[model samples]
Target: MKVADFHYERPDSLAKALVLLSRDDADVQALAGGQSLMPMMNFRLAQPDTLVDLNALEELRGIREAANHIEIGAMTRYAMLEASDLVRKHIPLFSIALPHIAHSAIRNRGTIGGSAALADPAAEMPALLIALNATITAVSTSGERKIAAKDFFLGLYETALDEGELIKSISVPKALIENRFGFYELTRRHGDYAMAGVAIAAQHMAPLTGLRIVFFGVSDRPLDVTAIAETLEGQSATDTDIVEAACRAIGNQSLHGDLNADAATKTHLAQVVLRRALRGMNA
Candidate 1:
């Protein structure tokens, strides 16, 4: 079915977009690449009265390197991130996960902010951000607020974004530039959403300490298993401790059943992916 009739507005500036969103009658939806939104609209799942297209607002579309972090514009496309030297050099986990987002055509049009706002539990970007401890900045009439990845996602298909707020920028820490990273997922096919997955970014030390293991497609939001890091510290990831800790870490999470897999199946796959990720990072 076609989407219900709607009005489209392309604002020249973000301030204008905010003004448009502030009106109660407007029901404006921010349009970035329209990869996810368009399909929903076509299926009659989403019918916004006004679509506030942000593409013409050039200010929200590039990448910058700060002294301590890499600031990526929210509107930057997945394809751009896949080929970005800065992203490869700094946020390697992000680069690793980019290929898992739908397909080339979708990646070419899907923006980072769009994916984050969509908050699909199986999507790679959200899990990668949580694994890297990234922070997102939101702009609205109430002023700007910085939200950590852990607090950014609220639940399935939901986030902390308030009305009239647009994700302006995301700041990713530069400290993990040289970190050893591994991303693994079990999808029915390539480009399909993960049935269960893991993104691991760990600091390679003499004894191999400072690890961050994050799980997706297994919970309400991205699950960061920092306790797994502590358990793996000062020990070889090849050891049995890593495997046991990985299992225990995931066992604590209350996974939900879905069309892709049941909760029990996901819990098993989560263990397998976790072990695979830890080995990949160590190897």
Candidate 2:
């Protein structure tokens, strides 16, 4: 199906884009890579009266190392992240997971910001960001605000982004030597959306250290099992310990399922993925 008629605006600057988005006179949607939005529009799942194209906004398109964090522009494509030394050095988890995002064609056009902003429960970026404790920067005519990854995702296709706010960039702390990371996802095909997934980032420091275990595709939003992390804190993190923690962490929560799998099946898959991720810390 073809998309319905809509007015299109290509903003050369972020300020211009923000202004275009803030106009309450029409239903405006921001367009990044157009990987997700285009399909939605084509199927009439999303019928925006206007589309504020962000491709021309150069400010939102690069990777840089800040004082203690790496700032990735919202428009940075998956292919860029997959090949970036800066990303591999600063956020190794991106390196491990980007290849699993989708096929080459999709990765070539999909933007990190688009994935996070869309807040698809089955996407990898949201869960990875939550595990890494990253921050999402959003901008608008009012001002700029930084939302923690944990607080950024509100629910399915929902986020803390106020109407007219555009995600500018995402910031992640530089990877540390003591940090161990793991990522796993279950999909019928290499490019298919994951049925269930898990991302784990653990700091094995001497004191005040713990891990963040985030699950996606099994809940309304990325589920952070901090309690599970706490349970494994200061333990040997052996296979048995990881399995036990996995069960204890997800055993009580109510996980939702779809035609792909039942709730019980998703929960079991979550446990399997979580265990593999935790074990990957030692790999």
Candidate 3:
């Protein structure tokens, strides 16, 4: 089906866009790259009455470096990120996840903010954000607020973003010298959504302290599995018995099934991904 008829407003300034979004009489939505939104709209998944085009907003279009973190504008495209030296140097794990997002055309048209805002349970960005302990900046007519990535995703295709507020940027802390990361996902094909995936981060080698295990395409949102991390704290990579016990905990969690895979299959795949990711970690 074609998208429902909607009013389009191409606001040159963010202030104007915010004003358009703040209107209470009709459903208002912000349009960035429109990669996801357009498809969703076309399928009747989204039926906004008015669309505030933010493509012209210069404030939402660049990657900047801070002393402690990298700030990426909401409108930054995946292709740009794939080519960014800063991203490759600082967030090497992101480099691993980027190539799996979709095809080159989708990557060229999809914005990081759009992916985060859409909050698809299977999307790589949300899970990576949580693994990196990133922050999202949200702006609106009322004011601006920062949300931790862990606290931002509320449920499947849902987020903590309030009405009329738009994602402004994302902030990710720079990886330290001792930091180590491992990312793995199982897809039917190269660019298909994963049946299950894992993103792992560790502080150092011998101790394996500050371990973060984030899983996607397995639950309502990215499952951090903090319990497993707590259990693995200070454990070396060779602790197979303890790792197996921790992985068994994954089987106990509630999982949602998709068309091609059942909950049990996804649970098994998730376990495999966790183990694979852990094995790939240096310590």
Q: Which candidate tops TM-score?
A: 2
List lDDT for all candidates, in order.
0.84, 0.89, 0.86
TM per model? 0.94, 0.96, 0.95
lDDT of 3: 0.86
Q: List the residue pairs that clash in candidate 1.
A: none
List, residue by residue over 1-283, the lDDT tens digit for candidate 3.
8999999999998888888998989999999888889999999999999988998998898888999899999999999899999999888888988999988999998899999999989989999999998999999999999999999999989999988899999999999989988888999999888889988777765666787778899888998875666666786745364357557667667888898799989888887887787777643
- Window of ten residues with lowest summed lDDT in model 3: 237-246
Name the candidate that leads on lDDT.
2
For residues 1-283, write the lDDT of model 1, one tens digit per residue: 7778899999999899888877776678998899889889999898999998988887888989999899988899889888889888888778777888899999998999888888988788898888788899999977899999888988888999998888998889875534778889989999988888998777764466777778898887887777876866877556356667877877887887698789999898988887777677667
User: Which runs in model 3 stand beyond 4 Å of their true positions?
Assistant: 237-242
